[model samples]
Target: MISVVLLGSGNVGTHFFKAIEKAENVRVAQWFSRQIDSIKGYKNKTAITDNLSELMEADLYILAVSDDAIATLSSALPFENRLVVHTSGSVNVHDLDKKNKRGVLYPLQTFSKGAEMDFKNVPICIETLDKKSYPILKEVATSLGSPTKRVNSNQRRVLHLSAVFVNNFTNQLYRIGHEITESEAAEFDLLKPLIMETAKKIQTLSPYMAQTGPAKRHDKKTIEKHLDLLKNPEHKAIYKLLTKSIQNTHGR
Candidate 1:
Protein backbone atom coordinates (compact mmCIF):
# COMPACT_ATOMS: atom_id res chain seq x y z
CA MET A 1 0.00 0.00 0.00
CA ILE A 2 1.19 3.51 -0.82
CA SER A 3 0.97 5.90 2.09
CA VAL A 4 0.37 9.61 1.42
CA VAL A 5 0.74 12.67 3.61
CA LEU A 6 -1.62 15.35 2.33
CA LEU A 7 -0.73 18.94 3.29
CA GLY A 8 -3.55 21.47 3.04
CA SER A 9 -7.30 21.69 3.65
CA GLY A 10 -8.53 23.69 0.69
CA ASN A 11 -10.81 22.66 -2.18
CA VAL A 12 -8.14 20.72 -4.08
CA GLY A 13 -6.93 19.01 -0.96
CA THR A 14 -10.43 18.03 0.15
CA HIS A 15 -11.38 16.75 -3.29
CA PHE A 16 -8.09 14.84 -3.66
CA PHE A 17 -8.50 13.30 -0.24
CA LYS A 18 -11.98 12.10 -1.16
CA ALA A 19 -10.69 10.61 -4.42
CA ILE A 20 -7.76 8.75 -2.88
CA GLU A 21 -9.99 7.40 -0.13
CA LYS A 22 -11.81 5.21 -2.64
CA ALA A 23 -8.56 3.66 -3.85
CA GLU A 24 -8.00 0.08 -2.75
CA ASN A 25 -4.22 0.19 -2.32
CA VAL A 26 -3.61 3.82 -1.27
CA ARG A 27 -4.19 5.32 2.16
CA VAL A 28 -3.87 8.83 3.56
CA ALA A 29 -1.15 8.63 6.19
CA GLN A 30 -1.85 12.10 7.56
CA TRP A 31 -3.81 15.29 6.87
CA PHE A 32 -1.81 18.36 7.92
CA SER A 33 -3.06 21.91 8.32
CA ARG A 34 -2.11 24.97 10.36
CA GLN A 35 -5.12 24.43 12.58
CA ILE A 36 -6.10 20.90 13.63
CA ASP A 37 -9.72 22.02 13.93
CA SER A 38 -9.84 22.72 10.22
CA ILE A 39 -9.69 19.00 9.44
CA LYS A 40 -11.43 17.56 12.47
CA GLY A 41 -13.39 14.99 10.50
CA TYR A 42 -10.25 13.48 9.03
CA LYS A 43 -8.75 12.96 12.46
CA ASN A 44 -10.45 9.60 12.93
CA LYS A 45 -9.55 8.43 9.47
CA THR A 46 -5.84 9.27 9.54
CA ALA A 47 -3.13 10.95 11.53
CA ILE A 48 -3.88 14.70 11.68
CA THR A 49 -1.20 17.11 12.81
CA ASP A 50 -0.22 20.77 12.64
CA ASN A 51 3.36 20.14 13.61
CA LEU A 52 5.65 19.65 10.62
CA SER A 53 8.20 17.82 12.73
CA GLU A 54 5.78 15.03 13.68
CA LEU A 55 4.88 14.01 10.13
CA MET A 56 4.55 10.27 9.72
CA GLU A 57 6.79 8.13 7.55
CA ALA A 58 5.01 8.04 4.20
CA ASP A 59 5.98 7.00 0.72
CA LEU A 60 4.55 10.20 -0.76
CA TYR A 61 3.70 13.71 0.37
CA ILE A 62 1.20 15.78 -1.60
CA LEU A 63 1.18 19.55 -1.00
CA ALA A 64 -2.09 21.13 -2.04
CA VAL A 65 -1.29 24.55 -0.61
CA SER A 66 -1.23 27.87 -2.47
CA ASP A 67 1.48 28.26 -5.13
CA ASP A 68 3.45 30.75 -3.06
CA ALA A 69 3.46 28.51 -0.03
CA ILE A 70 4.74 25.36 -1.73
CA ALA A 71 8.39 26.40 -1.59
CA THR A 72 8.41 27.42 2.06
CA LEU A 73 6.28 24.48 3.20
CA SER A 74 8.27 21.88 1.33
CA SER A 75 11.54 23.44 2.48
CA ALA A 76 10.38 23.18 6.07
CA LEU A 77 9.67 19.46 5.86
CA PRO A 78 11.97 17.80 8.38
CA PHE A 79 12.91 14.92 6.13
CA GLU A 80 14.64 14.91 2.74
CA ASN A 81 14.67 12.67 -0.36
CA ARG A 82 11.08 11.53 0.23
CA LEU A 83 8.73 11.90 -2.70
CA VAL A 84 7.11 15.35 -2.36
CA VAL A 85 4.52 16.51 -4.88
CA HIS A 86 2.29 19.57 -5.31
CA THR A 87 -1.12 19.90 -6.96
CA SER A 88 -0.56 23.13 -8.88
CA GLY A 89 -1.23 23.64 -12.58
CA SER A 90 1.03 26.65 -13.19
CA VAL A 91 3.77 26.32 -10.61
CA ASN A 92 6.88 24.61 -11.93
CA VAL A 93 7.78 21.23 -10.49
CA HIS A 94 11.26 22.64 -9.85
CA ASP A 95 9.70 25.35 -7.65
CA LEU A 96 9.37 22.91 -4.82
CA ASP A 97 12.31 22.82 -2.40
CA LYS A 98 15.26 20.74 -3.52
CA LYS A 99 15.64 19.27 -0.04
CA ASN A 100 13.25 16.49 -1.00
CA LYS A 101 12.44 14.63 -4.21
CA ARG A 102 10.10 17.10 -5.90
CA GLY A 103 7.33 16.48 -8.42
CA VAL A 104 3.84 17.65 -9.48
CA LEU A 105 0.44 15.93 -9.63
CA TYR A 106 -1.77 18.67 -11.03
CA PRO A 107 -5.43 17.74 -11.49
CA LEU A 108 -6.74 19.65 -14.49
CA GLN A 109 -10.18 20.49 -13.08
CA THR A 110 -11.57 23.45 -11.21
CA PHE A 111 -12.34 22.48 -7.64
CA SER A 112 -15.06 23.95 -5.43
CA LYS A 113 -15.76 23.57 -1.76
CA GLY A 114 -18.97 21.52 -1.95
CA ALA A 115 -18.98 20.41 -5.57
CA GLU A 116 -18.33 16.71 -5.95
CA MET A 117 -16.02 15.98 -8.90
CA ASP A 118 -15.79 12.61 -10.62
CA PHE A 119 -12.15 11.66 -10.77
CA LYS A 120 -12.86 9.53 -13.83
CA ASN A 121 -13.23 12.65 -15.98
CA VAL A 122 -10.54 14.79 -14.36
CA PRO A 123 -7.12 14.53 -16.02
CA ILE A 124 -4.15 14.29 -13.66
CA CYS A 125 -1.05 15.97 -15.14
CA ILE A 126 2.07 14.41 -13.62
CA GLU A 127 5.68 15.59 -13.74
CA THR A 128 8.89 14.52 -12.07
CA LEU A 129 12.63 15.20 -12.28
CA ASP A 130 13.42 11.57 -11.52
CA LYS A 131 12.28 8.69 -13.75
CA LYS A 132 11.75 6.45 -10.71
CA SER A 133 9.26 8.94 -9.20
CA TYR A 134 7.05 8.85 -12.31
CA PRO A 135 5.57 5.47 -11.53
CA ILE A 136 4.64 6.51 -8.01
CA LEU A 137 2.65 9.56 -9.25
CA LYS A 138 1.15 7.52 -12.12
CA GLU A 139 0.03 4.92 -9.60
CA VAL A 140 -1.66 7.62 -7.50
CA ALA A 141 -3.38 9.03 -10.58
CA THR A 142 -4.58 5.59 -11.69
CA SER A 143 -5.73 4.77 -8.19
CA LEU A 144 -7.78 7.97 -8.16
CA GLY A 145 -9.44 6.92 -11.45
CA SER A 146 -7.91 9.87 -13.34
CA PRO A 147 -6.48 9.70 -16.84
CA THR A 148 -2.76 10.40 -16.47
CA LYS A 149 -0.71 12.61 -18.78
CA ARG A 150 3.01 13.36 -18.57
CA VAL A 151 3.26 17.18 -18.73
CA ASN A 152 6.51 19.10 -18.50
CA SER A 153 6.50 22.27 -16.39
CA ASN A 154 6.30 24.66 -19.37
CA GLN A 155 3.54 22.71 -21.11
CA ARG A 156 1.54 22.61 -17.91
CA ARG A 157 1.85 26.40 -17.57
CA VAL A 158 0.48 26.97 -21.07
CA LEU A 159 -2.25 24.39 -20.58
CA HIS A 160 -3.27 26.08 -17.35
CA LEU A 161 -3.38 29.51 -19.02
CA SER A 162 -5.49 28.03 -21.81
CA ALA A 163 -7.84 26.66 -19.17
CA VAL A 164 -8.29 30.22 -17.85
CA PHE A 165 -9.53 31.24 -21.29
CA VAL A 166 -11.69 28.16 -21.75
CA ASN A 167 -13.18 27.91 -18.28
CA ASN A 168 -12.70 31.12 -16.34
CA PHE A 169 -13.23 33.56 -19.18
CA THR A 170 -16.21 31.60 -20.46
CA ASN A 171 -17.80 31.68 -17.02
CA GLN A 172 -17.35 35.45 -16.83
CA LEU A 173 -19.18 35.80 -20.15
CA TYR A 174 -21.98 33.71 -18.68
CA ARG A 175 -22.20 36.15 -15.80
CA ILE A 176 -22.55 39.05 -18.20
CA GLY A 177 -25.29 37.20 -20.09
CA HIS A 178 -27.05 36.56 -16.80
CA GLU A 179 -26.90 40.22 -15.90
CA ILE A 180 -28.39 41.24 -19.26
CA THR A 181 -31.19 38.74 -18.94
CA GLU A 182 -31.91 39.69 -15.35
CA SER A 183 -32.17 43.37 -16.25
CA GLU A 184 -34.91 42.55 -18.76
CA ALA A 185 -36.67 40.19 -16.32
CA ALA A 186 -36.00 37.31 -18.73
CA GLU A 187 -35.31 33.83 -17.44
CA PHE A 188 -31.57 33.24 -17.50
CA ASP A 189 -32.35 29.51 -17.45
CA LEU A 190 -33.63 29.88 -21.02
CA LEU A 191 -30.02 30.17 -22.21
CA LYS A 192 -28.95 26.81 -20.72
CA PRO A 193 -29.73 24.83 -23.85
CA LEU A 194 -27.95 27.34 -26.06
CA ILE A 195 -24.90 27.32 -23.80
CA MET A 196 -24.80 23.54 -23.68
CA GLU A 197 -25.22 23.27 -27.46
CA THR A 198 -22.36 25.72 -28.04
CA ALA A 199 -20.13 23.52 -25.89
CA LYS A 200 -21.34 20.30 -27.55
CA LYS A 201 -20.68 21.65 -31.03
CA ILE A 202 -16.97 22.21 -30.30
CA GLN A 203 -16.61 18.48 -29.66
CA THR A 204 -17.04 17.73 -33.37
CA LEU A 205 -16.42 21.08 -35.09
CA SER A 206 -13.49 23.41 -34.84
CA PRO A 207 -14.40 26.47 -32.79
CA TYR A 208 -13.80 28.72 -35.81
CA MET A 209 -16.18 26.67 -37.89
CA ALA A 210 -18.69 26.38 -35.04
CA GLN A 211 -18.78 30.15 -34.58
CA THR A 212 -22.16 31.71 -35.55
CA GLY A 213 -23.25 35.14 -34.34
CA PRO A 214 -23.75 38.72 -35.42
CA ALA A 215 -20.14 39.37 -34.44
CA LYS A 216 -18.95 36.50 -36.62
CA ARG A 217 -20.88 37.85 -39.60
CA HIS A 218 -19.75 41.41 -38.84
CA ASP A 219 -23.36 42.61 -38.70
CA LYS A 220 -22.58 46.24 -38.04
CA LYS A 221 -26.23 47.13 -37.37
CA THR A 222 -26.79 44.38 -34.80
CA ILE A 223 -23.37 45.04 -33.20
CA GLU A 224 -24.19 48.74 -32.86
CA LYS A 225 -27.60 47.86 -31.37
CA HIS A 226 -25.93 45.60 -28.79
CA LEU A 227 -23.46 48.30 -27.80
CA ASP A 228 -26.32 50.81 -27.45
CA LEU A 229 -28.31 48.36 -25.27
CA LEU A 230 -25.47 47.92 -22.82
CA LYS A 231 -25.87 50.62 -20.15
CA ASN A 232 -22.72 49.88 -18.20
CA PRO A 233 -19.60 51.50 -19.66
CA GLU A 234 -17.59 48.40 -18.81
CA HIS A 235 -20.16 46.17 -20.49
CA LYS A 236 -20.18 48.39 -23.59
CA ALA A 237 -16.40 48.32 -23.73
CA ILE A 238 -16.39 44.51 -23.45
CA TYR A 239 -19.01 44.22 -26.19
CA LYS A 240 -17.06 46.48 -28.55
CA LEU A 241 -13.79 44.69 -27.81
CA LEU A 242 -15.26 41.24 -28.44
CA THR A 243 -17.01 42.35 -31.59
CA LYS A 244 -13.84 43.95 -32.91
CA SER A 245 -11.83 40.84 -31.98
CA ILE A 246 -14.25 38.56 -33.84
CA GLN A 247 -14.24 40.76 -36.94
CA ASN A 248 -10.45 40.96 -36.94
CA THR A 249 -10.03 37.21 -36.42
CA HIS A 250 -12.39 36.29 -39.30
CA GLY A 251 -11.02 39.04 -41.57
CA ARG A 252 -14.44 40.59 -41.79
Candidate 2:
Protein backbone atom coordinates (compact mmCIF):
# COMPACT_ATOMS: atom_id res chain seq x y z
CA MET A 1 0.00 0.00 0.00
CA ILE A 2 1.16 3.54 -0.76
CA SER A 3 1.46 5.69 2.33
CA VAL A 4 0.83 9.44 2.03
CA VAL A 5 1.65 12.38 4.31
CA LEU A 6 -0.98 15.05 3.74
CA LEU A 7 0.13 18.56 4.73
CA GLY A 8 -2.56 21.21 4.88
CA SER A 9 -6.11 21.30 6.15
CA GLY A 10 -7.93 23.57 3.71
CA ASN A 11 -10.62 22.61 1.24
CA VAL A 12 -8.39 20.69 -1.17
CA GLY A 13 -6.42 19.03 1.60
CA THR A 14 -9.52 18.01 3.53
CA HIS A 15 -11.12 16.55 0.42
CA PHE A 16 -7.94 14.65 -0.46
CA PHE A 17 -7.88 13.04 2.98
CA LYS A 18 -11.52 11.95 2.72
CA ALA A 19 -11.01 10.50 -0.78
CA ILE A 20 -7.87 8.62 0.22
CA GLU A 21 -9.69 7.17 3.21
CA LYS A 22 -11.99 5.32 0.81
CA ALA A 23 -9.26 4.22 -1.60
CA GLU A 24 -8.15 0.60 -1.22
CA ASN A 25 -4.50 0.96 -2.22
CA VAL A 26 -3.53 4.19 -0.51
CA ARG A 27 -3.73 5.56 3.04
CA VAL A 28 -2.83 8.82 4.76
CA ALA A 29 0.01 8.06 7.18
CA GLN A 30 -0.11 11.50 8.72
CA TRP A 31 -1.89 14.83 8.39
CA PHE A 32 -0.23 18.20 9.18
CA SER A 33 -1.68 21.61 9.72
CA ARG A 34 -0.19 24.81 11.10
CA GLN A 35 -2.98 24.91 13.64
CA ILE A 36 -3.64 21.42 14.99
CA ASP A 37 -7.26 22.19 15.64
CA SER A 38 -7.96 22.45 11.92
CA ILE A 39 -7.48 18.69 11.65
CA LYS A 40 -8.18 17.70 15.24
CA GLY A 41 -11.25 15.73 14.17
CA TYR A 42 -9.10 13.30 12.17
CA LYS A 43 -6.76 12.50 15.10
CA ASN A 44 -8.63 9.23 15.68
CA LYS A 45 -7.97 8.15 12.10
CA THR A 46 -4.33 9.13 11.48
CA ALA A 47 -1.35 10.79 13.07
CA ILE A 48 -1.75 14.56 13.18
CA THR A 49 1.04 17.03 13.88
CA ASP A 50 1.96 20.71 13.69
CA ASN A 51 5.72 20.15 13.78
CA LEU A 52 7.55 19.35 10.55
CA SER A 53 10.26 17.43 12.39
CA GLU A 54 7.67 15.00 13.69
CA LEU A 55 6.57 13.95 10.17
CA MET A 56 6.74 10.22 9.76
CA GLU A 57 8.18 8.21 6.91
CA ALA A 58 5.77 7.87 3.98
CA ASP A 59 5.80 7.00 0.30
CA LEU A 60 4.50 10.42 -0.66
CA TYR A 61 4.33 13.90 0.86
CA ILE A 62 1.48 16.01 -0.52
CA LEU A 63 1.68 19.76 0.11
CA ALA A 64 -1.92 20.68 -0.47
CA VAL A 65 -1.40 24.15 0.86
CA SER A 66 -2.05 27.48 -0.86
CA ASP A 67 0.03 28.20 -3.96
CA ASP A 68 2.07 30.85 -2.18
CA ALA A 69 3.07 28.48 0.62
CA ILE A 70 4.25 25.50 -1.43
CA ALA A 71 7.82 26.65 -1.83
CA THR A 72 8.34 27.80 1.74
CA LEU A 73 6.68 24.74 3.24
CA SER A 74 8.56 22.28 1.05
CA SER A 75 11.82 23.91 1.99
CA ALA A 76 10.96 23.54 5.64
CA LEU A 77 10.30 19.80 5.45
CA PRO A 78 12.54 17.89 7.87
CA PHE A 79 13.09 15.11 5.36
CA GLU A 80 14.10 15.21 1.74
CA ASN A 81 14.56 13.20 -1.49
CA ARG A 82 11.11 11.67 -1.04
CA LEU A 83 8.27 12.06 -3.53
CA VAL A 84 6.82 15.50 -2.78
CA VAL A 85 3.92 17.07 -4.65
CA HIS A 86 1.61 20.03 -4.41
CA THR A 87 -2.04 20.23 -5.45
CA SER A 88 -1.84 23.42 -7.46
CA GLY A 89 -2.66 23.98 -11.12
CA SER A 90 -0.68 27.15 -11.73
CA VAL A 91 2.34 26.47 -9.54
CA ASN A 92 5.28 24.92 -11.37
CA VAL A 93 6.65 21.55 -10.25
CA HIS A 94 10.11 23.04 -9.84
CA ASP A 95 8.80 25.50 -7.27
CA LEU A 96 9.21 22.88 -4.57
CA ASP A 97 12.57 23.04 -2.80
CA LYS A 98 15.11 20.75 -4.55
CA LYS A 99 15.63 18.91 -1.28
CA ASN A 100 13.13 16.31 -2.48
CA LYS A 101 11.69 14.83 -5.67
CA ARG A 102 9.05 17.34 -6.78
CA GLY A 103 5.80 16.88 -8.69
CA VAL A 104 2.23 18.13 -9.00
CA LEU A 105 -1.10 16.34 -8.63
CA TYR A 106 -3.58 19.07 -9.44
CA PRO A 107 -7.22 18.14 -9.28
CA LEU A 108 -8.94 20.22 -11.93
CA GLN A 109 -12.18 21.00 -10.14
CA THR A 110 -13.68 23.63 -7.87
CA PHE A 111 -13.67 22.74 -4.18
CA SER A 112 -15.64 24.27 -1.35
CA LYS A 113 -15.89 23.44 2.32
CA GLY A 114 -18.94 21.31 3.25
CA ALA A 115 -19.62 20.42 -0.40
CA GLU A 116 -19.71 16.82 -1.56
CA MET A 117 -17.20 15.84 -4.24
CA ASP A 118 -17.02 12.61 -6.18
CA PHE A 119 -13.37 11.74 -6.67
CA LYS A 120 -14.11 9.51 -9.66
CA ASN A 121 -15.28 12.48 -11.66
CA VAL A 122 -12.41 14.86 -10.87
CA PRO A 123 -9.58 15.03 -13.45
CA ILE A 124 -6.09 14.83 -12.00
CA CYS A 125 -3.41 16.78 -13.86
CA ILE A 126 0.02 15.26 -13.15
CA GLU A 127 3.42 16.86 -13.63
CA THR A 128 6.78 15.83 -12.31
CA LEU A 129 10.33 17.18 -12.46
CA ASP A 130 11.78 13.67 -12.36
CA LYS A 131 10.70 11.04 -14.86
CA LYS A 132 10.39 8.23 -12.28
CA SER A 133 7.96 10.25 -10.17
CA TYR A 134 5.29 10.15 -12.90
CA PRO A 135 4.15 6.58 -12.32
CA ILE A 136 4.02 7.05 -8.57
CA LEU A 137 1.82 10.16 -8.87
CA LYS A 138 -0.28 8.40 -11.52
CA GLU A 139 -0.78 5.42 -9.24
CA VAL A 140 -1.95 7.66 -6.41
CA ALA A 141 -4.37 9.41 -8.73
CA THR A 142 -5.66 6.08 -10.03
CA SER A 143 -6.21 4.92 -6.47
CA LEU A 144 -8.53 7.87 -6.02
CA GLY A 145 -10.51 6.70 -9.08
CA SER A 146 -9.73 9.93 -10.96
CA PRO A 147 -8.83 10.21 -14.61
CA THR A 148 -5.19 11.24 -15.00
CA LYS A 149 -3.72 13.51 -17.65
CA ARG A 150 -0.07 14.42 -18.16
CA VAL A 151 0.18 18.20 -18.35
CA ASN A 152 3.18 20.50 -18.46
CA SER A 153 3.33 23.56 -16.25
CA ASN A 154 2.28 25.83 -19.14
CA GLN A 155 -0.66 23.63 -20.08
CA ARG A 156 -1.76 23.47 -16.46
CA ARG A 157 -1.68 27.26 -16.25
CA VAL A 158 -3.84 27.58 -19.33
CA LEU A 159 -6.26 24.99 -18.01
CA HIS A 160 -6.50 26.92 -14.73
CA LEU A 161 -7.15 30.21 -16.57
CA SER A 162 -9.88 28.59 -18.67
CA ALA A 163 -11.40 27.12 -15.53
CA VAL A 164 -11.59 30.58 -13.99
CA PHE A 165 -13.58 31.78 -16.99
CA VAL A 166 -15.96 28.84 -17.05
CA ASN A 167 -16.51 28.32 -13.33
CA ASN A 168 -15.73 31.57 -11.51
CA PHE A 169 -16.90 33.98 -14.18
CA THR A 170 -20.01 31.94 -14.95
CA ASN A 171 -20.94 31.84 -11.27
CA GLN A 172 -20.64 35.63 -11.09
CA LEU A 173 -23.01 35.86 -14.04
CA TYR A 174 -25.47 33.71 -12.10
CA ARG A 175 -25.18 36.13 -9.17
CA ILE A 176 -26.00 39.00 -11.48
CA GLY A 177 -28.99 37.10 -12.81
CA HIS A 178 -30.16 36.61 -9.25
CA GLU A 179 -29.88 40.32 -8.56
CA ILE A 180 -31.78 41.18 -11.75
CA THR A 181 -34.61 38.79 -10.95
CA GLU A 182 -34.89 40.11 -7.40
CA SER A 183 -35.17 43.68 -8.65
CA GLU A 184 -38.18 42.67 -10.73
CA ALA A 185 -39.76 40.59 -7.95
CA ALA A 186 -39.32 37.48 -10.14
CA GLU A 187 -38.27 34.05 -9.01
CA PHE A 188 -34.63 33.41 -9.82
CA ASP A 189 -35.39 29.72 -9.48
CA LEU A 190 -37.36 30.05 -12.72
CA LEU A 191 -34.03 30.18 -14.56
CA LYS A 192 -32.82 26.92 -13.05
CA PRO A 193 -34.05 24.73 -15.94
CA LEU A 194 -32.48 27.02 -18.51
CA ILE A 195 -29.18 26.88 -16.69
CA MET A 196 -29.26 23.11 -16.50
CA GLU A 197 -30.32 22.78 -20.13
CA THR A 198 -27.56 25.08 -21.27
CA ALA A 199 -25.01 22.96 -19.37
CA LYS A 200 -26.52 19.75 -20.78
CA LYS A 201 -26.44 21.04 -24.34
CA ILE A 202 -22.69 21.67 -24.17
CA GLN A 203 -22.18 18.01 -23.30
CA THR A 204 -23.38 16.80 -26.70
CA LEU A 205 -23.07 19.99 -28.76
CA SER A 206 -20.17 22.33 -29.21
CA PRO A 207 -20.62 25.58 -27.30
CA TYR A 208 -20.59 27.46 -30.63
CA MET A 209 -23.38 25.28 -31.99
CA ALA A 210 -25.32 25.46 -28.72
CA GLN A 211 -25.34 29.24 -28.75
CA THR A 212 -28.79 30.85 -28.62
CA GLY A 213 -30.68 33.95 -27.35
CA PRO A 214 -30.61 37.62 -28.38
CA ALA A 215 -26.88 38.19 -28.71
CA LYS A 216 -26.33 35.05 -30.75
CA ARG A 217 -29.30 35.91 -32.94
CA HIS A 218 -28.17 39.54 -33.32
CA ASP A 219 -31.52 40.70 -31.97
CA LYS A 220 -30.53 44.30 -31.44
CA LYS A 221 -33.94 45.26 -30.08
CA THR A 222 -33.83 42.60 -27.39
CA ILE A 223 -30.23 43.48 -26.57
CA GLU A 224 -31.14 47.14 -26.17
CA LYS A 225 -34.10 46.21 -24.03
CA HIS A 226 -31.85 44.23 -21.71
CA LEU A 227 -29.29 47.00 -21.44
CA ASP A 228 -32.03 49.52 -20.68
CA LEU A 229 -33.61 47.27 -18.06
CA LEU A 230 -30.35 46.95 -16.14
CA LYS A 231 -30.46 50.05 -13.89
CA ASN A 232 -27.16 49.29 -12.14
CA PRO A 233 -24.35 50.77 -14.21
CA GLU A 234 -22.06 47.88 -13.32
CA HIS A 235 -24.61 45.32 -14.43
CA LYS A 236 -25.30 47.26 -17.62
CA ALA A 237 -21.57 47.40 -18.34
CA ILE A 238 -21.25 43.65 -17.90
CA TYR A 239 -24.30 43.04 -20.07
CA LYS A 240 -22.94 45.26 -22.82
CA LEU A 241 -19.51 43.64 -22.68
CA LEU A 242 -20.89 40.11 -22.80
CA THR A 243 -23.35 41.01 -25.55
CA LYS A 244 -20.52 42.40 -27.61
CA SER A 245 -18.41 39.35 -26.93
CA ILE A 246 -21.20 36.99 -28.02
CA GLN A 247 -21.91 39.06 -31.10
CA ASN A 248 -18.24 39.00 -32.05
CA THR A 249 -18.06 35.26 -31.47
CA HIS A 250 -20.92 34.62 -33.88
CA GLY A 251 -19.72 37.20 -36.45
CA ARG A 252 -22.88 39.23 -35.77
Please name the candidate that would achieve the greatest TM-score relative to the true structure.
Answer: 2
lDDT (0 to 1) per candidate: 0.92, 0.94
Best by lDDT: 2
Tell me model 1's lDDT, rounded to 2 decimals: 0.92
TM-score for each candidate, following the candidate numbering: 0.97, 0.98
Give the clashing pairs for model 1: none
> For residues 32-141, what per-residue lDDT tens digits would candidate 1 score against the true structure?
99978889988788889999999999999999999999989988999988999999988888888898888999999999979999999899999999899999899999
Put down candidate 2 lDDT per residue, 212-251, tens digits, no spaces.
8899989989888888898999999998898889999999
Poorly placed runs, candidate 1 (over 4 Å): none
**C-alpha positional error of residue 110 in candidate 2 after TM-score superposition, expressed in Å:** 0.8
